[model samples]
Target: MKQYDKKMIVKKSNELIDAGFELSLNESRLILYCVAQILPKQPIKPDEMYFVDAKNFSELFHLDIAGVYKTLKNAMHKLGDRWATVIDKNGDPKEIRWIISRQYFENQGVLGIQFHPEMLPYVSALKKHFTQYDIKFISRMKSSYGIPIYELLTKRRDLKEQTFTIDVLKRKLKLEGRYSAWRDFKRYVIEPAMNDLNNEFGEFDATYKTVKEGRAIVAVTFHYKPRNKSIPLFDKQGNPSSEAPQKRWEEYGYRSAFEFREALELSETHEFDLTDAKEFLKARGKPANK
Candidate 1:
C-alpha cells in the first residue's frame, strides 16, 4: 500500500465530518484511509461494499459489520433522507443492495462507480479491517437531480414570505383539512429542503428586524462567487480543451426581504379598496392572502 499524506487525510476527514458523519480522530483517519482507497476508481457499489445477504459489511477495520451498519445508519439519519438508502434491484426489497443515498453521492461528485485514482490506497487500507466481509462500491444507474430546499425557498421567497397565516398557507398550498400543516411544512418542506441545499452549497444568513409595532420582518443573505478568466480554447500543445473562461471573479451578495405576517395584514387593512367594499370586507375577517 502507498503511504498517505497527513494533510490529505485530514482534509478528507474534515469533508466526511462536514457531510454529517461523526467519528473519533482515529476512526476518522481510518475512514479517510478507506475512502482514499475506494474513491480512486469511483464510489463503490453496494455489492462491492457488502455481502449479497447485506448482513455483513466488508472488513475495513476491526469493527464488526453490525457496528459499521449502525455507524452508517446514524450518519445517514443525521444527513436526512438525502444521504440514506439501500439499493434494491428493480425496486424489489428482497434483492437488497446497500447503497448510499443518491443526493449525498452526487454532492460528493461521484458521478459513477469510478473514483479518482488518488483515493484508492485509502480504500485498500479500509478493507483490511473487513477481510471476512465482501463489499464493493458500484456506480449508480440513475441520475440525481433533486433541488435543495434552501434554493427553492430562495427562488420563491415571495410565496414563502407571504403573510399567509396558518390557514392561508394551508389553503393556498391545497393542504386544508390536514392537521399540523404548518408544523409539517416547517419540518418536512422548509427545514429539510433548505438544509439539504445549505449542505450541498453553503448556508444563507438569516436575520429579522422590527418593521412596525407587533410586526417583524425576515431577511436572508447569500454570497455567490463570479467567474473571472477567459475561456481556454486549447491546451499548450494546441489540442482542444473543454475549459471555459473564468469570468471576472468576485463575491456577489444577494438579500431577500419579507414582510412580517402582522405587517402584511395591517397593510392590507389600511389600503382596502373602496371599489369593492363587499369583497374587501369579506377578506378582512378571512385569513391574510399569501
Candidate 2:
C-alpha cells in the first residue's frame, strides 16, 4: 500500500480546542486550511491575507466542486460573526472573533480571511500542549459533530485520560438545549462521532468511560493513543468503512436506535430498546441484518 501523506498539519492551543464554538463542516475546513499555513515559530501578520479557493475546499472535504464556490462564500460571510470563548492569561473569559476581515474574490473563485489580533495567542507561537492533527482525518467524516469530536480527542492524545463534565461537553460542542437525555445524546451525538474517529483517524484510537451520579451520567473520560497507523480513507471501491453511521447500525438489525424506536412508536425522550425490533422483524418472517 502506498503511504498516506498528510501535506498540511493543523495546530491550535489546548484552550482553543476546548473552547465553545459552533461551525458547519465547510466553515471548519476553511479555518483549518488557513491555520495549516502557519509555521510553528513564525509570526502571523495581521495585514496578511490568507486565501482559500473553492477548488481546494471541495477537494479537501470531498464536497461537490460545482457547489463549493457558494459554500465557500457563505461560510466566509458568516465566519466573521462567529466567536470563540477562551479563558485569557488572567483566567478571565474573553470572547474572540475567528476572523477580523474576510475577502471575497468572486471572479477568482477564492475567499480570503485575516485572523483577529486577539486570536494570536491561541493559533500562533504555541509553546506547548497544542493540539495537532492531520486535516485529512476529518475530510471524509459526514457528521458536523465529527469535526469537534476529532479535535477533542486530538487535544488529549498525549495524556492517559482526560475527563469532561456532561455540561462542559455539551457547551464545547454547542449542543445546549438538545440531547438532554443521555440515551439520545449518546445515540445521536457521541456514538456517531466516535465511529467516525475510530475508522477515519489514523493517529489514535479513542474510547470513553462514563461516570454516573447515581443513575444519571454526569461526565465522561476519554482515552486516546495510536494503536494502528494505517486506516485507508479513500479507495476505488468507496468511502472508508465507517463513513456512514446508518450502514454500521444496520448490522444490528436497525439503522439506529432512532429507527428502532420509531418502528414501535417509542418516545425519543425515553431509552432505546432494540428487543422489540428483533421480535417485530421475526414476526414478519424476515431475517435480521447480518
Candidate 3:
C-alpha cells in the first residue's frame, strides 16, 4: 500500500488543561496521529469518524505485526474508557470522555473511532489560546510522562518556567494515587522523563526545583530551555565520535602529517601508514617532515 506522510496536531481544550486528566501516553499519541492522518485539511466535522487500516497504523508508527495488534487492543480496551473532567467559565464541572463510539474489524484489519462530539470543536477549528504541537515531538519520548510534561512546558515556554502546587502537579500528571510520596514521584516519574527529554533534546533541556513553605514542600518549579538544535560533536562518551569527521583540510588546519596522526591517535582505532599520511599532508600544503 502507498504510504502517506503521517502528521498530526495535538489540540487540547483550555478547560481540559485546567482540569487535568490521565491517559496511556503511548495509546494517546498513536490514536491522535492516526485520526489526524484521515482528517481533512479544513476543520474536522463532528459527524466525521475515521476508519484506518491496522497495517497503515503499523507502518506510520514503525510497529511490527504483533505491535500493531497489541496497540489496537490497547486502544480499544484502555483508551475507550478514558475520560477527563473540565470546568467551564460558569464554574460548571463537565466530564469529557475521548471516544464517542469505536469499533474494530478483526477479519478486515480495520479500526474506526469517532471522537466525542463535544471534543470536535476543541480538536478542530482551533483558533487561539490552545496548546498545539506537532505529533513528531512525542514520537521518540520513552517515558509516559514526557509528552504531558512537554506539552505543559511548551505552553509556557515563553515564561521558561512553570510552578505547580504539589496537588495540582499530581493532577496534571494524572498520578493521583500512583506516587504518594514526593520523593518517589520525583525519582521515578519526574527524573526519568526529564532525562529522556534531555537525552533526545540536549543536556539540561528540562529541570525543576522544589518550592517549600517552612520546610513543608508546597510546590515545584520547572524550568525548560528550547532543545539544542545543533548537532553533537562527540558521542555520549567523550570520545572521537563515529559521526563523519570534518572533511576539508582548512576545517581542521593540520600543519603537518604529525598533527593529523596525533588527531587519529585520539581514536586509538584508526590506522594510518606514513606514505598515506605524506600524500594527505602534501595535498594540504604541509610537508610530511615539517
What's the best-to-worst order under TM-score?
2, 3, 1
True-vs-predicted CA distance for residue 251, candidate 3, Å: 29
Identify the candidate with maximal lDDT: 2
lDDT of each: 0.28, 0.69, 0.59
All candidates' TM-scores? 0.22, 0.72, 0.68
CA lDDT of 73 in candidate 2? Answer: 85
Error of 1 at 84 (Å): 8.8
lDDT of 3 by residue, 1-290 (tens): 33434444455545555656677755666556654543222557676777767776666544665667667867667767787767766887677777777777888888777888876655654334555445555655667777667767765444667898878878776778777777898887888778766766232377889998897777888887765321112222323233534353234565643354343332222223322444444444432221
What is the lDDT for 52 in model 3? Answer: 63
lDDT of 1 by residue, 169-215 (tens): 33323345664634554554344433433332232332212222244
Colliding residue pairs in candidate 2: none
Give the per-residue lDDT of model 2 (tens digit) for 1-290: 22334366677888999898888777888898988767554557777788997777777766767878888888888898999888777988788999899988989898899999888778875545566666777777776677887788665443547788889989887788989999999998888877766775445577888999999999988787655422222111211222212322256576553343243322111233334456445433433221
Q: What TM-score quantifies how close candidate 2 is to the native fold?
A: 0.72
Which candidate wins on TM-score?
2
Q: Which of 1 and 2 is ahead in lDDT? A: 2
- Itemize residue pairs with steric clashes in candidate 3: none
- Candidate 1 ranges beyond 4 A from true positions: 1-47, 50-70, 73-180, 187-189, 192-290
